[model samples]
Target: MVTLEQVKHQCRIDHNDEDTLLLGYVAAARDHVQRYLDRTIYDVAVPSEDPDGVLDNASIDQATLMLVGHWYAHRESVSETSMNEVPMGVTSLLAPYRHIGI
Candidate 1:
């Protein structure tokens, strides 16, 4: 649900060469957050999306951006440095939205 401008701003890149890649990160991040939450973050602007979120869009947006930042920072699965779990607070932000079932 984040934009190219936001992703660029987050990654501190001012060039457009990686716009497509950045945008891809946005989508992947959205999917990642959605899957984690087991719920959809509704955007009133998107007509087909159901407005069923109990939380604000900003929470989801922030969570997605957290993921985007992580994925953007680490492009390769095999990092030169030690691996870390998903960026801090990703679960913290999305946990409230998680679907708890019987």
Candidate 2:
């Protein structure tokens, strides 16, 4: 998905204190997006990794970043701010990559 630096840049953080935490969020976000699309997204980190069932596209990457930003901002399940629109955007980004029943 996204790198820790990318996540930090997205979240506008200027510190390295939370690199591990941010990396964790990145992994979780990547997995979540992959699951939502019902397929594996390509992993650039592992160049030797299998390419089968993998999607290497910008939308999926952006969606993953969006999710990480959202999760990073809102750590808790519940928040005072309404987040009903975030998922819609993520879905739209992942829609093309999403597998539908035939």
- Distance from true location, Cα of 78 in model 2, Å: 0.6
Tens digit per residue, CA lDDT, model 1, 1-102: 578887888789989898888888888888777777776656655334554444437778888887889888878778778865655578877777787766
Q: How many residue pairs clash in each candidate?
A: 0, 0
lDDT by residue for model 2 (1-102), tens: 567778898899999998898899988988888788777676554244543356567787788788888888889999886556855588998887776657
Q: After superposition, how far is residue 76 of candidate 2 from its true place, in Å?
A: 0.3
Candidate 1, 85: how far from true, in Å? 4.6
The candidate maximizing lDDT is: 2
Q: What are the models' TM-scores?
A: 0.80, 0.82
Off by over 4 Å in 1: 45-56, 85-88
Please report the TM-score between candidate 2 and the true structure: 0.82
Runs of candidate 2 exceeding 4 Å displacement: 44-52, 86-88
Score candidate 1 by TM-score against the native.
0.80
